[model samples]
Target: MNTVTPPKERAAAPETAPASRRSLLKRPRQLWAVTGPLVIFVVMLAIVAGLTPTFLGSNGLTFIAAAAAPILLLALGQALVLNIGSIDLSNAAIAVLGAILLAFLLAPLAAAAPLLVLLIVTLFGAVNGLLVAYAQVPSFALTLGTLGIFQAAALVLSGSTTVYVSANGEAISALYQSGILGIPMTFWIGVVLAIVLWAGLRFTRLGLAMTAIGNNESGAIFSAVRNRRVKVVVFALSGFTAGLASIAIIAQSGSASATGAGGDLLLPAITAAILGGTSISGGVANPINVIFGALTVALVPIATTAIGVDAQAQNLVYGLVIIVVVALTMARTRGAVVK
Candidate 1:
């Protein structure tokens, strides 16, 4: 007598079919996932270029690169902290504080800007790490508190006024304004940082472990991951990045003010991280996409001016664009889940 296949085997056969179908669908989804934002960026650029030929000029490009450097640096820091399911609101304040410190204390060591900046940033990072990791406070609360504290410290250091980078203007300028093989220094720095971080996340065990911790801290702990240590390291790295950003700002603007501690930066930095496909809920980060996100954010003002939009209106447009993109991404993500 011929025996039919068991029902369980029949079910397994259909499951395999669905899996193959899902894989086929995944390819297009992945393509759109990256291409959607890219397409928007190109459209925006083309519109701006059509409106104003100067939009593509060398001076305009330099201005965008220079302006984007500090924000890009800060976003990179935020991205790192975010990758591990944590937030760092203290970035702007930390940057201000670092700039003040550099102007007053480290400027004398002109020959050692790189080394001095590294040490100061390391210390700032360690402080953040200790408070967040060992103290067991939520990163949001911890960083928020530190934000105020650091801002106050910056004010005190600057005496509540802008501190000009006149003393070491040449050195600072060289750091931010000079070019390497014709590429702007600031642009090169951002590119290098992005590449290094991308490599780390792709090829390193620590990077995989950080993703695991971010995805599920409790589960990662059960699987023997050092969650606390990893979080601390991530926070420290964030601080370091903030410090680097501060140097860039000081170099480019030649001044630091308390007013600069909170304005036009917080939202965009977070937006860049999210828009780059780094999950707001953490667990995933794409450095390459983040670079594009940075470029997109940086281009907004240029585009607006080229198109003759008022500054206030441009701000509104930026806020609206961020909201729309985020909503779309969320909807697409949900659809994928349902499907």
Candidate 2:
């Protein structure tokens, strides 16, 4: 009888749940993470456009696109290496080498020049892959060594002089200076390559495996990811991109110099990759952000000149911006798991 007593009223429910709807928002830091760089980029663009009216004009736009193409291509290569927790300092050197070959060796072949350059690039990439993947050398050391070797080769080939393509060298010039649909050909090539890489990274199994290896090699190995093979492929792709970039540079300048593209390109190329939201520690990559980053870096110098800033000051500012971006990215990624 007692047990049947109205199922013992559950001790009155502890305080009733609050009735007001609770709204949640992203943390302030997270908001800044996305908006800070975007705001700065927009502001910079506005300032440049205001000071150099040409910046908003077709000619200026074309110039920007042309200038950005090589770096964007090189940055894509760098981004690939970085994604695998490696670095390729030899990109500019490879580009310079390819330019020299194009001017001296392949130039005679005319229409076949691009194919020969592509072959050379593939070879260079293969070597890098073999050494890094098979020989077990640290990427930094290996690439640095190759950088010097490639530069020396370039110098020997160019003989302390610039190799000029005839102004009317239609085929060679087309690689760099020509365009399709009112856009520079080099620019178009870069856009296409970027799209391809972005798609590969997003839609392919190899891309997923590479990302997994980059994020954690040990974990990837445990999970049966073929790390070595993937890394080799990545290095090869980087080399191919560098080679293509070299051709573009040669076309733009209508010449190849012994110094190659010069070391001036190295920092900027790396900076673009780092600033593009690609992890330096290796993981996922953002090609769209990389494109924007390359454009921003290219525009800095253009804007500086248009605004009458000294070259030295421009370099200083560029360095500062890179450092700040890297620091911010590191802070956000530290102690956080990527996958």
Candidate 3:
């Protein structure tokens, strides 16, 4: 046996142990992975609290919530899509079109405008899913192409202007205007949606399937995971969230402007998701954490003001911080697959 042994054969003889929940709980890296983002969130808030002193007061909190709501929803959608190892660049475009189309519908349909708008965006998501999952097109490329088309369509549809809602349009207009216990109604809606998103990703079989597919596509297919169907549904769900976010957007401004209104959110939402501890690679994500991620992102301008940093410097700082955190997290899971 000793005389016949070869180097290549010996190297292949050892099998790696499978990762287990018990081992995960024991690993400090697991602890850091779960706690790091939360720590960042608290630290950011603490800095803000110290700098402004009044920023945590009632009015300040309300202002932050109202501003962060749409971003939170967008981050929610982005997190979901990214969890499945995919990207969606069409969100901002969808939001723009959703708002414009809703405004156009409201003049005639009135109370039915919101429902109709949600349905339209949902269908658009399904189409996106089909193209990405069935056509074998890369999500990044497909979404980018769709992005240009939708943005152009929105502008052309609106004739390059902002859409406005009348005060008389109370039913639809109140979506952004009304509040409960002094909080924006949209904020409550966002909270509910966050819970739903979290539950879907963390508790459902479909969520697990998505995670499996993200973790190992070949293995998932071998294990009978409905990879295509799960991806389609993920895209559809992302679209549904985009629809909700679009409502919030229109509610805030009372119109969907054809001039790149929603487009700006895509990058920030993605940054928030990554910062929230959703892995850049496939296999790990937490939707609930993304809400706090939105909060941390929303705090950027505020943090800049608090620290006397220039607005222009904020993005650079945000990027550096997120990149470092992600790098460290990746290092922690370097040896074995994470899910």
Candidate 4:
């Protein structure tokens, strides 16, 4: 005897099949999210090793780590800004400005100069946060304006020339020249910072707020997350990291200039963040994998040079790599927007 089932139960029973199928289909994308960037990095290194044969040697590895260190630092800052649905075009500028300030203050401030520079940049970044949060300014336009402000300040301070760190150079130089446990200090600092930031994102209230806000601001607000405060802290962290990166730059070069590392590093830093699996659409970031992304970028120019590619061709390779990687890593969820 056929019995009439309740309408609610009948409707609910059919939903499970499609839901299970979706779950099955989603597993591959989830897996790709975790492993894809790493696979690309490994494959690139393998290709380079095949061409050079000596690319896997200790010296080659060390060079890659060292070169990637500063880029990683800059990428870390960029990732923090990106995670919250914002971008900081001024991070590299902040680095240059910090470097110049550190150099100028080293003689008088001595051991305290680095701290002071970090504080200044952090505060500068907070200002950016304030404008974006309270004043309702768009991050892109605000940061672009601040980028000019930072560059102008850098130029004025450095007299449009390189500011050499003759006094207290050792304090900054040790960050790049010295090592602990056979790893360069710059790389060590980057690794430590990455771990710390990763932990924050994985196990902290602030991190949760950032993720929620980025994914859906209205929903996050409904959840009682302090979206504006979290943004301020995020930008402050970005600024502090930029200052840290400036220290690495100054240490590596023994000087700071307006048109030096900062100007050249913005593109690579942003590329590293995106390639590291940070979604440009916001609400996604992987700090640890960002290290791999930085390594890949660091390897590019070297690989190109080793393969007899000219500088112009090397740039073309960078552009192509960015485009391909962005396409691969972009989060394509329903209703996702790139802006």
Candidate 5:
């Protein structure tokens, strides 16, 4: 009989080897996403400590906490917008307008001024969200347009001048100057807010919807997610936080200015969010991690000074850090367009 013996079945080992290797490779990336910001913060702190021993003192640490507080709020807001697959270029501008409004309303509204400012900015953000959700406007363009409008409005409202909260400044002033357990009150507020946000994002239905929409809007829609409502809420939160940050700014400076309210904060806030492991392509964010990012940014100028670098070179260093971090964390897929 010429019947050949059946070919021995191929071993399953070769087939599973590549899959196992891929699983192993994915783990490091997952770990990196969680720990990268902390690593960077520690490295930066070490460098500063090595170069300038004075930076490890109580006063320096306190200053960093206070200075980073406002940026932390702004970055938290930016992180929300980015999570929803959108960008709010107007957040910084919103802060400026809120400061102007806060300055004008404090005497008349008293303690209610901050509350009113928060409401106004939240509504302002809702409008942006409405246009993006229902009107189908691209967020980048819409926010860019609103940025110009808000800036112009601020200039007109403040008459191109700084507004001082001379009479009723005490309430706002306490936010920055007061400390609890050796930390600034402003820092405590930021920390509390971050914890609340983190809890909401981790445990709520709204957070699930946000992640879904960011991951795949069409899929989210198919899955019965109320995409528009979620977006509106997300942007409203962004605006609310911006307003909160404006209060912090006024507290720190004891006054508000059209130029200084937002100032160079927009870029730094975006950088902080990104550095904190919030994916720029959306679908992920961590308010807790973002605190470390804010601290990293606040350390930039201090780090530069500690290392004897020129002050003007700070922006260059920021640009470099942003580029490197983005390159590493950006999501990539087949046929994905850069736009």
Candidate 6:
């Protein structure tokens, strides 16, 4: 009797290939990745520069930098999460919670408060990771449920009042106040963070695993990637970033509302990520592009105010701009595969 033959499984791509570096830097699609945001940035800048002669001037530029700071960090966190094929709906809520905790803790803990808040935030993210990775819960449902719980907890814990730490606007605002080369420290800090994230995502084995799983989970499993551990770390990084953003929010407002006032930033954060060439679906992230995307988004409101344009008009324009950026980036990614 003839025995039935089993089909052989296809092999996964080699994990240690040097093609990763070349693929990142030499991909023709990478050019579009940079150009799309840079072009949008320059165009909007020109329009705003023409509309208000001062928009691109020294102080006007500083204003944009300051405004973009916290939102940019939130976008950073969101971009990282999206890269891993997940979402963190509680990112802004966590920032608000961290701010409130920082305000109260800074009085007693001093500089250590930021550290403590980051730890707590990381733990919160660990919980999300555990549920999502081990329990197989849908990230959207998990994050959405956690969002409500965390937001309500923040409101209740802080009595729905704005908390102002005495030290909030002091050394914490140093970056917002000072600039090097006429560029605000806020923008510089964002650039530094972008570089750090880019390096982590490009040069590290952890980053390789994250991308592998994001792009193709079955392949990653076939390659023996530690999928669950990577998820936890990525989510933890997102939470840590959210905590860092709380410091920026405190510096900007000199206070934080318990009702999670900055929670509204979630939309703009997601917008900036998408605008930065990050795929909402998964498997794409460019922190450098995120910086440019952030700068462009930050300038819009400032531009409207400078030119005396109504918020309604600005919203209309903002929607159009975001649509254009997303479309261009998506097309670029698709074109790269086609080629």
Write down the TM-score of every candidate: 0.86, 0.84, 0.86, 0.89, 0.88, 0.87
lDDT of 5 by residue, 66-157 (tens): 87888899899899899878999999899989988898888888888899999999999899999999999999999999999999999999
Clashing pairs in 4: none
How much lDDT does each candidate structure score?
Answer: 0.73, 0.75, 0.77, 0.84, 0.83, 0.78
Candidate 6 Cα deviation (angstroms), residue 269 = 0.7
In the predicted model 3, the residue pairs found to clash are none
Task: Give the Å error, residue 65, model 1.
Answer: 1.7
Compared with the true structure, what per-residue lDDT tens digits does model 4 show for residues 40-109? 8888888888888876675676777778888899999889889888998998898999989988888888
Ten-residue region with minimum lDDT total, candidate 2: 17-26
The candidate 1 region of ten consecutive residues with least summed lDDT is: 330-339
| Tens digits of per-residue lDDT for model 3, 252-291 | 7777786745768888788778777776666778877777
Model 6: per-residue Cα lDDT over 86-165, one tens digit each: 98888888888888888878777777887898899889878888888999888889989999988987888788888887
lDDT digits (tens) for residues 192-275 of candidate 1: 998898899879988878888777788889999888788777878888878788778777777778777433476677877777
- Is candidate 5 or 6 superior in TM-score? 5
Candidate order (lDDT): 4, 5, 6, 3, 2, 1
Can you give the lDDT of residue 90 in candidate 4? 90
- Those runs of model 5 whose alpha carbons end farther than 4 Å from true positions after fitting are 1-26, 326-339
Q: Per-prediction RMSD in angstroms?
A: 6.4, 9.8, 6.4, 6.2, 7.8, 6.4
TM-score of 6: 0.87
lDDT of 2 by residue, 1-339 (tens): 001213333443343544111111334544444344455567778988888777677476677778888898889988888888888988888888887777775546776777788788868977987899889899989999999998898888778788776433567677656677566888778878878888988789998887787778899999998888988889888889887887788778777886646345777888878777677778757666677677777877777877778877987876776677566543254446443
lDDT of 6 at 324: 74
Best by TM-score: 4
Q: Is candidate 2 or candidate 3 better by lDDT?
A: 3
Clashing pairs in 2: none
Q: How accurate is candidate 6 locally (lDDT)?
A: 0.78
